[model samples]
Target: SDQISKDESMVGFVDDLQFFIDNRDGETVVGLKQKLEICGRGAAFNDAKKKKELFAKLLMRFERFSSAQQLFAYIMAAIHETFDTKIIPSTSSLSTQEIDAMIEAEIVDKIMAEIGEGSDHMTLNRTHIKGMIYWLADKCYVRWHCD
Candidate 1:
Protein backbone atom coordinates (compact mmCIF):
# COMPACT_ATOMS: atom_id res chain seq x y z
CA SER A 1 0.00 0.00 0.00
CA ASP A 2 2.79 2.43 0.75
CA GLN A 3 4.45 1.60 -2.52
CA ILE A 4 3.64 4.58 -4.75
CA SER A 5 1.30 2.42 -6.89
CA LYS A 6 2.25 2.05 -10.56
CA ASP A 7 4.80 4.84 -10.81
CA GLU A 8 7.44 4.29 -8.18
CA SER A 9 8.39 7.94 -8.19
CA MET A 10 5.30 8.82 -6.20
CA VAL A 11 6.61 7.02 -3.15
CA GLY A 12 10.14 8.47 -3.35
CA PHE A 13 9.36 10.84 -0.52
CA VAL A 14 7.72 8.10 1.56
CA ASP A 15 10.85 5.97 1.47
CA ASP A 16 12.75 8.92 2.85
CA LEU A 17 10.15 9.77 5.48
CA GLN A 18 10.67 6.84 7.86
CA PHE A 19 14.40 7.20 7.46
CA PHE A 20 14.17 10.90 8.13
CA ILE A 21 11.98 10.30 11.14
CA ASP A 22 14.33 7.64 12.44
CA ASN A 23 17.49 9.68 12.12
CA ARG A 24 16.22 12.67 14.05
CA ASP A 25 19.13 12.92 16.45
CA GLY A 26 20.32 16.04 18.30
CA GLU A 27 22.67 17.50 15.74
CA THR A 28 20.65 16.89 12.60
CA VAL A 29 17.51 18.52 13.93
CA VAL A 30 18.22 21.81 12.26
CA GLY A 31 18.70 20.18 8.89
CA LEU A 32 15.46 18.34 9.42
CA LYS A 33 13.61 21.57 10.08
CA GLN A 34 15.13 23.17 7.04
CA LYS A 35 14.17 20.21 4.87
CA LEU A 36 10.69 20.33 6.29
CA GLU A 37 10.48 24.00 5.51
CA ILE A 38 11.26 23.12 1.93
CA CYS A 39 8.95 20.14 2.14
CA GLY A 40 6.17 22.46 3.24
CA ARG A 41 6.98 25.46 1.10
CA GLY A 42 4.21 25.11 -1.45
CA ALA A 43 1.48 24.54 1.10
CA ALA A 44 0.00 28.03 1.44
CA PHE A 45 0.47 29.28 -2.12
CA ASN A 46 1.77 32.63 -0.80
CA ASP A 47 3.60 33.59 -3.99
CA ALA A 48 2.59 32.89 -7.57
CA LYS A 49 6.02 31.72 -8.68
CA LYS A 50 6.62 29.05 -6.05
CA LYS A 51 3.06 27.85 -6.34
CA LYS A 52 3.33 27.50 -10.09
CA GLU A 53 6.64 25.68 -9.87
CA LEU A 54 5.27 23.27 -7.28
CA PHE A 55 2.09 22.46 -9.17
CA ALA A 56 3.85 22.16 -12.48
CA LYS A 57 6.41 19.79 -11.07
CA LEU A 58 3.78 17.65 -9.44
CA LEU A 59 1.65 17.46 -12.55
CA MET A 60 4.53 16.60 -14.86
CA ARG A 61 5.76 14.07 -12.36
CA PHE A 62 2.46 12.41 -11.56
CA GLU A 63 0.57 12.62 -14.81
CA ARG A 64 1.30 9.06 -15.78
CA PHE A 65 0.62 7.80 -12.29
CA SER A 66 -2.95 9.00 -12.55
CA SER A 67 -5.26 6.06 -12.70
CA ALA A 68 -8.68 5.13 -11.37
CA GLN A 69 -7.34 2.38 -9.12
CA GLN A 70 -4.53 4.50 -7.75
CA LEU A 71 -6.93 7.29 -7.00
CA PHE A 72 -9.33 4.87 -5.38
CA ALA A 73 -6.55 3.22 -3.43
CA TYR A 74 -5.21 6.58 -2.29
CA ILE A 75 -8.63 7.71 -1.19
CA MET A 76 -9.28 4.49 0.61
CA ALA A 77 -5.92 4.50 2.39
CA ALA A 78 -6.19 8.04 3.73
CA ILE A 79 -9.77 7.54 4.83
CA HIS A 80 -9.32 4.11 6.35
CA GLU A 81 -5.91 4.48 7.92
CA THR A 82 -4.92 8.09 8.39
CA PHE A 83 -7.64 10.64 9.09
CA ASP A 84 -11.28 11.19 9.95
CA THR A 85 -13.28 12.70 7.14
CA LYS A 86 -16.79 14.08 6.91
CA ILE A 87 -18.72 13.75 3.67
CA ILE A 88 -20.82 16.87 3.72
CA PRO A 89 -19.82 17.66 0.17
CA SER A 90 -20.41 15.29 -2.68
CA THR A 91 -17.51 13.74 -4.61
CA SER A 92 -18.89 15.18 -7.83
CA SER A 93 -18.05 18.69 -6.69
CA LEU A 94 -14.56 17.75 -5.61
CA SER A 95 -11.77 19.36 -7.63
CA THR A 96 -8.14 18.48 -7.85
CA GLN A 97 -7.24 21.62 -5.92
CA GLU A 98 -9.57 20.88 -2.98
CA ILE A 99 -8.37 17.31 -2.76
CA ASP A 100 -4.80 18.56 -2.90
CA ALA A 101 -5.51 20.95 -0.06
CA MET A 102 -7.01 18.25 2.09
CA ILE A 103 -3.95 16.08 1.62
CA GLU A 104 -1.38 18.87 1.87
CA ALA A 105 -2.85 21.00 4.62
CA GLU A 106 -5.86 19.80 6.59
CA ILE A 107 -4.77 16.25 7.42
CA VAL A 108 -1.36 17.32 8.70
CA ASP A 109 -2.91 20.12 10.72
CA LYS A 110 -5.55 17.83 12.17
CA ILE A 111 -3.04 15.24 13.31
CA MET A 112 -0.62 17.82 14.66
CA ALA A 113 -3.39 19.57 16.53
CA GLU A 114 -4.67 16.37 18.04
CA ILE A 115 -1.26 15.00 18.93
CA GLY A 116 0.24 18.32 20.03
CA GLU A 117 3.85 19.42 19.54
CA GLY A 118 6.52 16.73 19.29
CA SER A 119 3.98 13.96 19.76
CA ASP A 120 4.58 10.63 18.05
CA HIS A 121 1.06 9.41 18.36
CA MET A 122 -0.43 7.81 15.26
CA THR A 123 -3.97 8.64 16.18
CA LEU A 124 -5.57 8.51 12.75
CA ASN A 125 -9.15 7.57 11.91
CA ARG A 126 -11.62 6.75 9.18
CA THR A 127 -13.30 10.02 8.34
CA HIS A 128 -14.23 12.17 5.39
CA ILE A 129 -10.84 13.46 4.26
CA LYS A 130 -8.67 10.38 4.66
CA GLY A 131 -8.86 9.32 1.04
CA MET A 132 -7.62 12.59 -0.28
CA ILE A 133 -4.92 12.90 2.36
CA TYR A 134 -3.35 9.54 1.60
CA TRP A 135 -3.07 10.29 -2.08
CA LEU A 136 -1.58 13.65 -1.32
CA ALA A 137 0.78 12.20 1.26
CA ASP A 138 1.99 9.63 -1.20
CA LYS A 139 2.51 12.33 -3.74
CA CYS A 140 4.47 14.49 -1.32
CA TYR A 141 6.51 11.77 0.35
CA VAL A 142 7.08 9.26 -2.45
CA ARG A 143 9.92 9.56 -4.94
CA TRP A 144 9.65 9.54 -8.71
CA HIS A 145 12.62 7.32 -9.40
CA CYS A 146 12.47 3.54 -9.54
CA ASP A 147 15.30 1.13 -9.14
Candidate 2:
Protein backbone atom coordinates (compact mmCIF):
# COMPACT_ATOMS: atom_id res chain seq x y z
CA SER A 1 0.00 0.00 0.00
CA ASP A 2 2.81 2.42 0.87
CA GLN A 3 4.52 1.63 -2.43
CA ILE A 4 1.27 2.22 -4.29
CA SER A 5 0.76 5.52 -2.50
CA LYS A 6 4.26 6.59 -3.40
CA ASP A 7 3.69 5.70 -7.02
CA GLU A 8 0.45 7.65 -7.03
CA SER A 9 2.19 10.72 -5.59
CA MET A 10 4.87 10.47 -8.23
CA VAL A 11 2.22 10.26 -10.94
CA GLY A 12 0.48 13.29 -9.52
CA PHE A 13 3.75 15.23 -9.52
CA VAL A 14 4.31 14.32 -13.15
CA ASP A 15 0.80 15.45 -14.01
CA ASP A 16 1.42 18.78 -12.24
CA LEU A 17 4.55 19.28 -14.36
CA GLN A 18 2.66 18.51 -17.55
CA PHE A 19 -0.05 20.99 -16.63
CA PHE A 20 2.49 23.69 -15.81
CA ILE A 21 4.38 23.18 -19.04
CA ASP A 22 1.19 23.25 -21.09
CA ASN A 23 -0.26 26.39 -19.53
CA ARG A 24 2.49 28.60 -18.17
CA ASP A 25 4.35 30.21 -21.02
CA GLY A 26 8.06 30.92 -20.53
CA GLU A 27 8.19 28.69 -17.45
CA THR A 28 11.51 26.85 -17.20
CA VAL A 29 12.82 23.88 -15.22
CA VAL A 30 14.05 26.32 -12.58
CA GLY A 31 10.57 27.78 -12.34
CA LEU A 32 9.16 24.31 -11.79
CA LYS A 33 11.68 23.74 -9.01
CA GLN A 34 10.65 27.01 -7.41
CA LYS A 35 7.02 26.03 -7.71
CA LEU A 36 7.76 22.72 -6.04
CA GLU A 37 9.58 24.41 -3.21
CA ILE A 38 6.71 26.85 -2.71
CA CYS A 39 4.19 24.03 -2.84
CA GLY A 40 6.13 22.00 -0.28
CA ARG A 41 6.21 24.88 2.17
CA GLY A 42 2.56 25.77 1.56
CA ALA A 43 1.52 22.19 2.25
CA ALA A 44 2.58 22.69 5.86
CA PHE A 45 -0.40 24.96 6.51
CA ASN A 46 -3.09 23.09 8.47
CA ASP A 47 -5.98 24.86 6.75
CA ALA A 48 -6.71 23.65 3.23
CA LYS A 49 -8.39 26.90 2.16
CA LYS A 50 -5.49 29.02 3.34
CA LYS A 51 -3.05 26.62 1.77
CA LYS A 52 -4.81 26.88 -1.59
CA GLU A 53 -5.01 30.67 -1.41
CA LEU A 54 -1.34 30.90 -0.46
CA PHE A 55 -0.25 28.55 -3.24
CA ALA A 56 -2.27 30.59 -5.76
CA LYS A 57 -0.44 33.75 -4.76
CA LEU A 58 2.89 31.95 -4.74
CA LEU A 59 2.29 30.53 -8.22
CA MET A 60 1.36 33.95 -9.59
CA ARG A 61 4.57 35.34 -8.14
CA PHE A 62 6.60 32.35 -9.34
CA GLU A 63 6.28 33.50 -12.97
CA ARG A 64 8.98 36.03 -12.15
CA PHE A 65 11.08 33.13 -10.73
CA SER A 66 12.72 34.65 -7.74
CA SER A 67 14.91 32.49 -5.50
CA ALA A 68 13.28 29.66 -3.56
CA GLN A 69 14.71 31.37 -0.50
CA GLN A 70 12.39 34.32 -0.99
CA LEU A 71 9.38 32.05 -1.37
CA PHE A 72 10.43 30.31 1.85
CA ALA A 73 10.57 33.68 3.54
CA TYR A 74 7.00 34.46 2.52
CA ILE A 75 5.91 31.02 3.72
CA MET A 76 7.51 31.63 7.10
CA ALA A 77 5.89 35.06 7.26
CA ALA A 78 2.45 33.59 6.55
CA ILE A 79 2.93 30.87 9.14
CA HIS A 80 3.98 33.40 11.75
CA GLU A 81 1.11 35.74 10.89
CA THR A 82 -1.47 32.97 11.05
CA PHE A 83 -0.15 31.40 14.25
CA ASP A 84 0.20 34.72 16.06
CA THR A 85 -3.26 35.93 15.14
CA LYS A 86 -4.82 32.62 16.10
CA ILE A 87 -3.68 33.07 19.68
CA ILE A 88 -4.94 36.66 20.03
CA PRO A 89 -8.15 37.23 21.92
CA SER A 90 -11.24 37.48 19.69
CA THR A 91 -12.91 39.93 22.03
CA SER A 92 -10.67 42.38 23.84
CA SER A 93 -11.43 45.23 26.18
CA LEU A 94 -9.06 47.46 24.25
CA SER A 95 -10.30 49.59 21.41
CA THR A 96 -10.23 48.06 17.93
CA GLN A 97 -7.48 50.39 16.87
CA GLU A 98 -5.42 49.51 19.93
CA ILE A 99 -5.87 45.81 19.42
CA ASP A 100 -4.90 46.11 15.80
CA ALA A 101 -1.72 47.93 16.78
CA MET A 102 -0.90 45.32 19.37
CA ILE A 103 -1.41 42.51 16.92
CA GLU A 104 0.83 44.27 14.42
CA ALA A 105 3.55 44.71 16.99
CA GLU A 106 3.35 41.09 18.08
CA ILE A 107 3.61 39.87 14.50
CA VAL A 108 6.51 42.17 13.70
CA ASP A 109 8.39 41.13 16.82
CA LYS A 110 7.85 37.45 16.15
CA ILE A 111 8.90 37.72 12.50
CA MET A 112 11.90 39.77 13.49
CA ALA A 113 12.97 37.29 16.14
CA GLU A 114 12.68 34.42 13.71
CA ILE A 115 14.46 36.19 10.88
CA GLY A 116 16.99 37.86 13.13
CA GLU A 117 18.69 34.52 13.60
CA GLY A 118 20.28 35.03 10.17
CA SER A 119 18.57 37.32 7.64
CA ASP A 120 19.20 41.06 7.47
CA HIS A 121 15.80 41.98 5.97
CA MET A 122 13.88 42.64 9.17
CA THR A 123 11.78 45.59 8.08
CA LEU A 124 8.09 45.21 7.23
CA ASN A 125 6.10 48.23 6.01
CA ARG A 126 2.82 49.32 7.53
CA THR A 127 0.81 48.25 4.50
CA HIS A 128 2.40 44.78 4.37
CA ILE A 129 1.91 44.36 8.10
CA LYS A 130 -1.71 45.42 7.82
CA GLY A 131 -2.19 43.03 4.92
CA MET A 132 -0.90 40.10 7.01
CA ILE A 133 -3.24 41.06 9.82
CA TYR A 134 -6.17 41.29 7.43
CA TRP A 135 -5.27 37.95 5.89
CA LEU A 136 -5.28 36.38 9.34
CA ALA A 137 -8.60 38.03 10.18
CA ASP A 138 -10.07 36.73 6.94
CA LYS A 139 -8.90 33.24 7.97
CA CYS A 140 -10.95 33.71 11.18
CA TYR A 141 -7.91 34.06 13.42
CA VAL A 142 -9.53 37.17 14.80
CA ARG A 143 -12.66 39.26 14.28
CA TRP A 144 -12.71 40.66 10.75
CA HIS A 145 -12.06 44.41 10.52
CA CYS A 146 -12.30 44.56 14.31
CA ASP A 147 -9.39 44.48 16.69
Candidate 3:
Protein backbone atom coordinates (compact mmCIF):
# COMPACT_ATOMS: atom_id res chain seq x y z
CA SER A 1 0.00 0.00 0.00
CA ASP A 2 0.99 3.60 -0.46
CA GLN A 3 2.00 5.76 2.49
CA ILE A 4 -1.29 7.61 2.70
CA SER A 5 -3.36 4.46 2.81
CA LYS A 6 -1.09 2.97 5.41
CA ASP A 7 -1.36 6.11 7.51
CA GLU A 8 -5.11 6.14 7.07
CA SER A 9 -5.25 2.68 8.51
CA MET A 10 -2.91 3.42 11.39
CA VAL A 11 -3.46 6.99 12.43
CA GLY A 12 -1.75 8.18 15.61
CA PHE A 13 -4.10 8.08 18.55
CA VAL A 14 -2.52 10.87 20.52
CA ASP A 15 -5.14 10.72 23.23
CA ASP A 16 -4.46 7.03 23.79
CA LEU A 17 -1.16 5.94 22.37
CA GLN A 18 -1.62 2.45 23.76
CA PHE A 19 -4.34 1.89 21.18
CA PHE A 20 -1.63 1.33 18.61
CA ILE A 21 0.03 -1.35 20.68
CA ASP A 22 -3.24 -3.09 21.32
CA ASN A 23 -4.21 -3.06 17.65
CA ARG A 24 -0.89 -3.67 15.96
CA ASP A 25 -0.16 -6.62 13.75
CA GLY A 26 3.30 -8.05 13.07
CA GLU A 27 4.06 -5.39 10.48
CA THR A 28 6.94 -3.03 11.18
CA VAL A 29 9.61 -1.03 9.36
CA VAL A 30 12.15 -1.67 12.12
CA GLY A 31 15.11 -3.47 10.55
CA LEU A 32 17.63 -5.64 12.38
CA LYS A 33 20.10 -2.84 13.05
CA GLN A 34 17.40 -0.55 14.37
CA LYS A 35 16.13 -3.31 16.64
CA LEU A 36 19.60 -3.88 18.02
CA GLU A 37 19.95 -0.20 18.84
CA ILE A 38 16.50 0.09 20.34
CA CYS A 39 16.53 -3.00 22.49
CA GLY A 40 19.36 -1.90 24.73
CA ARG A 41 18.59 -4.27 27.59
CA GLY A 42 18.58 -7.42 25.44
CA ALA A 43 15.83 -9.74 26.60
CA ALA A 44 15.03 -7.48 29.50
CA PHE A 45 13.53 -4.98 27.07
CA ASN A 46 10.62 -7.30 26.61
CA ASP A 47 8.34 -4.53 25.36
CA ALA A 48 9.95 -4.44 21.93
CA LYS A 49 6.70 -5.48 20.33
CA LYS A 50 4.82 -2.62 21.91
CA LYS A 51 7.60 -0.22 21.01
CA LYS A 52 7.49 -1.34 17.39
CA GLU A 53 3.77 -0.74 17.26
CA LEU A 54 4.21 2.75 18.63
CA PHE A 55 6.92 3.46 16.09
CA ALA A 56 4.64 2.47 13.27
CA LYS A 57 1.92 4.64 14.68
CA LEU A 58 4.32 7.56 14.90
CA LEU A 59 5.18 7.11 11.23
CA MET A 60 1.52 7.31 10.46
CA ARG A 61 1.27 10.53 12.39
CA PHE A 62 4.19 12.00 10.53
CA GLU A 63 2.55 11.17 7.26
CA ARG A 64 -0.84 12.47 8.31
CA PHE A 65 -0.02 15.68 10.14
CA SER A 66 2.29 18.50 9.14
CA SER A 67 2.71 19.45 12.79
CA ALA A 68 3.87 15.95 13.57
CA GLN A 69 6.38 16.03 10.73
CA GLN A 70 7.78 19.31 12.00
CA LEU A 71 7.94 17.93 15.51
CA PHE A 72 9.85 14.92 14.20
CA ALA A 73 12.47 17.12 12.62
CA TYR A 74 12.74 19.23 15.75
CA ILE A 75 13.21 16.12 17.86
CA MET A 76 15.92 14.80 15.56
CA ALA A 77 17.78 18.10 15.74
CA ALA A 78 17.49 18.23 19.51
CA ILE A 79 18.75 14.67 19.92
CA HIS A 80 21.71 15.29 17.62
CA GLU A 81 22.63 18.50 19.40
CA THR A 82 22.42 16.98 22.88
CA PHE A 83 24.18 13.72 21.99
CA ASP A 84 27.00 15.36 20.10
CA THR A 85 27.69 18.24 22.44
CA LYS A 86 27.04 16.66 25.83
CA ILE A 87 26.70 12.89 25.89
CA ILE A 88 29.56 12.07 23.53
CA PRO A 89 32.14 14.22 25.29
CA SER A 90 31.42 12.82 28.74
CA THR A 91 33.91 10.30 30.06
CA SER A 92 31.35 8.42 32.08
CA SER A 93 29.64 5.37 30.63
CA LEU A 94 25.90 5.93 30.59
CA SER A 95 23.53 3.04 30.09
CA THR A 96 21.14 3.31 27.15
CA GLN A 97 18.18 3.84 29.47
CA GLU A 98 20.00 6.61 31.28
CA ILE A 99 21.04 8.23 28.03
CA ASP A 100 17.47 8.07 26.78
CA ALA A 101 16.19 9.59 30.01
CA MET A 102 18.65 12.44 29.79
CA ILE A 103 17.81 13.15 26.18
CA GLU A 104 14.08 13.04 26.88
CA ALA A 105 14.42 15.38 29.81
CA GLU A 106 16.41 17.86 27.79
CA ILE A 107 14.00 17.69 24.89
CA VAL A 108 11.05 18.28 27.21
CA ASP A 109 12.73 21.28 28.73
CA LYS A 110 13.42 22.76 25.31
CA ILE A 111 9.89 22.07 24.15
CA MET A 112 8.34 23.59 27.23
CA ALA A 113 10.34 26.73 26.74
CA GLU A 114 9.33 26.86 23.11
CA ILE A 115 5.68 26.51 24.00
CA GLY A 116 6.01 29.24 26.58
CA GLU A 117 7.42 31.49 23.89
CA GLY A 118 4.40 30.85 21.63
CA SER A 119 6.06 28.40 19.32
CA ASP A 120 3.76 26.58 16.91
CA HIS A 121 4.82 23.11 18.00
CA MET A 122 2.05 20.89 19.16
CA THR A 123 1.73 20.18 22.84
CA LEU A 124 2.25 16.58 23.86
CA ASN A 125 2.57 14.80 27.15
CA ARG A 126 5.59 12.84 28.30
CA THR A 127 4.25 9.59 26.89
CA HIS A 128 3.91 11.11 23.44
CA ILE A 129 7.36 12.63 23.68
CA LYS A 130 8.92 9.32 24.69
CA GLY A 131 7.05 7.58 21.90
CA MET A 132 8.54 10.04 19.40
CA ILE A 133 12.06 9.31 20.67
CA TYR A 134 11.58 5.58 20.38
CA TRP A 135 10.13 6.10 16.94
CA LEU A 136 13.21 8.10 16.01
CA ALA A 137 15.38 5.20 17.14
CA ASP A 138 13.34 2.76 15.09
CA LYS A 139 13.67 4.96 12.02
CA CYS A 140 17.46 5.25 12.40
CA TYR A 141 17.18 8.99 13.02
CA VAL A 142 18.80 8.76 16.46
CA ARG A 143 20.74 6.30 18.58
CA TRP A 144 21.06 6.02 22.32
CA HIS A 145 24.81 5.68 22.02
CA CYS A 146 27.53 5.82 19.42
CA ASP A 147 28.06 2.67 17.45
Q: Pick the candidate with the highest TM-score.
A: 3
Candidates sorted by lDDT, descending order?
Answer: 3, 2, 1
Q: Candidates sorted by TM-score, descending order? A: 3, 2, 1
How many residue-pair clashes does candidate 3 contain?
Answer: 0
Error of 2 at 99 (Å): 0.7
User: Candidate 1 at 137: error in angstroms?
Assistant: 9.9
Give all candidates' CA lDDT scores.
0.35, 0.39, 0.51
lDDT string, candidate 3, 1-147, tens digits: 133333443345343333322423442435434455444545523464466466556556455554455455565567556656876454158766776567656775676565443233334554455555555555445444454
Deviation from truth (RMSD, Å), model 2: 15.5
- Output the lDDT of residue 139, model 3: 48
Compared to the true structure, candidate 2 yields what TM-score?
Answer: 0.35
Q: Identify the leading candidate in terms of lDDT.
A: 3
TM-scores for every candidate against the unseen true structure: 0.24, 0.35, 0.52
lDDT of 1 by residue, 24-121 (tens): 23332232223224434333333333433453354345443323234334433433343324321322355545644654454546554543442121
Which residues of candidate 1, in runs, are more than 4 Å off? 1-89, 119-147
Residue 78, candidate 3: how far off, in angstroms?
1.6
